[model samples]
Target: MAFASGSRADRPNIVLVVADDQGWGDVGYQGHPVLKTPHLDEAARSGLRFERFYAQAPVCSPTRATLLTGRHPNRMGVFTWGYPIRPQEITLAKLLREAGYATGHFGKWHLGSVYRASPVHPGRMGFERWVSSPNFFDNNPIFSDEGTAVPFQGESSVVTVQVALEWIRKQAEAGRPFFAMICFGSPHAPHQAAEEDRALYLDQPPALREFYGEITGIDRAFGMLRQALAELGIRENTILWYTSDNGALPKVGSTGGFRGNKGQIYEGGLLVPTFLEWPAKIRTPRVTRVRCCSADIFPTILEIVGIEPPANLPLDGISLVPVIEGKWERRPVPLGFWHYPAPGISTPSAKWMAELLAAQQKGEDLPPDGPSQRAGQLPDPPYPSDQFPGHAAWIEGDWKLHRIETAKGKIRWELYNLEEDPAESTDRAAEEPERLGAMQKRLEAWLRSVVQSLNGADYAGLGESPSLPESKSR
Candidate 1:
């Protein structure tokens, strides 16, 4: 598609909203028995709902990285939750800002440090304004406003949306196109919900009341945001996309009957509830089961705004423009997911932000070498070029193949026809040898490519320090 450099009115405003640790079966539209997500349900009904949407990873930060860069997180060395996005990678926000759009980010910014001096801070990543937290936060949170800690009161989701809407309204009044990433830190662990929201689920267990209450708060906050858009008269042209960072939490969250939860690479872990509303482009409501992932977000937005992605940038995600326009029923490219065994880096939002706030109040500063700035520090390549540890999966059409690397160095492969077995309860590897072999070969090749990217082959002249392996790929 040609780059869209049309008038300001011709370009659609974009709002990407993400929920933290929200499960596939958490919303009312998805047949959740208890949770009431009236706002999200209406949005799903009125727009394009995705039946098989997925987070690129089964955790937080990696999936967020994929959403921002249109590449697998592993490609940029963001292997798990709490990992920071590589500063060398091109971000969607930076591209949009360069294309004459005002860009801002609110709420959880788990991809990297929110400190002003951090190389991977939101400002460095192209957002002009940011009220972000280093990790998930609950009510009455402290956020970094371009690196200065600012305390805010109220429910976390409500405060996040209100702040974003304030910036959005200004851009709308000025008649400039804007892109806002509103990420909500809700229903994660230590579930804390506003009392009123918690009251809605009185009949449920105490733990569930808190869990469901946070979702209810998110639902109400989402409603407030959507209502504001309509009230501002920018609802028609704005593309409002809603999805979760990962899958459901264990015990407290629901996955709509998929196998595993959260950390696993099963359907419950990767699959997420997703919907997009763009009234100007999608006049009619529809639902699509064509497979898509968080990585698709960056490319899809770029195609919509008519921005050409940087040449030679390897994107694991394909433009979903065709899917949005109702032109394509199937994804042309298969989605690949990997769970590298690297441990998650620690980034406690409440603790870190409090320290930042105290330091600022006392006219002091935290150490530059703190864990918050670890995202900018590249690690040495410890694994061999051919050694891909942990679990990986390849998805093509209705077939899914799993490549498991046991800790003892044993490798196992499992294949399942997801169409017939959503839970992956029965492995079809033994039943369908021919299909299994083809998928296995394709998956191995893809893993090698990811390893090459991880080793910094893609940053040839990008000025990034490449952690090149001693030997080339076998």
Candidate 2:
């Protein structure tokens, strides 16, 4: 029981609802052509809608790492698809637990290899009770609860809501200030829905038919989630944060008017919908246009709880508490982003990623080194880390610079002033050489700093003060 027992005056339960592969246009507020999300829309209507909010990465594990650790996924060792979040990193759950919030992770836990001995398993990663899956589970899929894989009935979204509801109820009964993360793997892939959710979109266009069904199912589950919170009399006090893992994935929902699908560094890949609903705190539904990211979640929670990080390990995210309270206009600091090392497995999951994760990390102390320690493993050559051309981007005011390494010239860079080109349709790199070069230098310097921390070069210094991208006066 790592969760400390704090005084009642110092605690508030946190419920972070993450929808997998859910797009900006999938919600009712965002105006999907046919999707029905009455509950989520109401959450948006009654809470603060964060426009220009982004997932830390273009994928789930990376984004989750950001939300939990208040830093880039690379800094925590979750670089790409199927990479496990290294155990040494700090997570929101761990922080909240230290601050006396009982933490539980319900739904998908994709930050690690789901195997029983993975170091980064949910239980080992600071969660008190974790009912999770290795990754996105199709309908009626198996879930690893703490250690055992159990079959769950009903749709994926519905089951996720139910598990979370049960956990919250238990925590409430125990009089504990709980921090539960419901990482719903809905709308991710293998888009399937119950007949009820399916019928709503059956008459729509071929492209939206199945996709809408998936979102609807997720919506219904969201409704149930809200109802459960209200029924428990905790809806008003709980901080309910809703957002997605990444932007709209390909062959699925719309990314609103943004260009490029998931996997690209465009706004579509990074920018997803976001909102914070706390009826007691955010009584009015205010639309905030400030830019924020998944990394902010952890630090904000710590700030709200008044648990100042040790003098050594400062946080990367600024507290949005003042913003939520309508006390500020713009973030006083700059935001950072790096889609680094590239899109490949960056961890030690050699060959057992599939079966091992399903079993969950059962043993105590769960072995530290996963696939990496296995000889003849370590993944083959052309690792995304080595071959994948990565782009380190920085958005200051209206400008975003992406220094890419394409054959177009080894040191290619593209600049997009989002104020003028929200869709990022045109590449003005060659046109504005001077401005591009300046921004590229800034981006490169930031990349170097990120790489230093990501490779564990500055863990000791991190506790003293989290690294920041060198400030540039745009």
Strongest candidate by TM-score: 1
List where candidate 2 sits over 4 angstroms from the true fold: 1-6, 205-207, 310-316, 341-369, 372-389, 407-409, 428-435, 461-474
Give the clash count for model 2. Answer: 11
Task: Name model 1 segments beyond 4 Å from true.
Answer: 1-5, 368-382, 463-474
- TM-scores of the models, in the order given: 0.95, 0.86
Write candidate 2's Cα lDDT for 71-148 as tens digits.
Answer: 777665567666676555666776667666778888887776544555566776778788778777767767766655
Per-model lDDT: 0.87, 0.71
Evaluate model 2: give its lDDT. Answer: 0.71
Find the candidate with the highest lDDT and give its number. 1
Q: Per model, how many backbone clashes are there?
A: 1, 11
Task: Evaluate candidate 2 by giving its C-alpha RMSD to the native, one decimal.
Answer: 7.2
Task: State the lDDT of candidate 1 residue by residue for 1-474, as single tens digits.
Answer: 332557767899999999999989989898989998899999999999999999999999999988888988988889887777877788898888878788889999898778767867777787888889988999999999878899999999999999898888889888988989999999788899899999999999999999999999999999999999999999998999999988888998999999989988999998898999998878899999899999899988998888887665689998888888788887888989999998988988899899999999998766532544665545475346677789999999899999999888899998988999999999989989999998888898988888877766777776643222221100
Alpha carbon deviation, residue 169, candidate 2 (Å)? 0.4
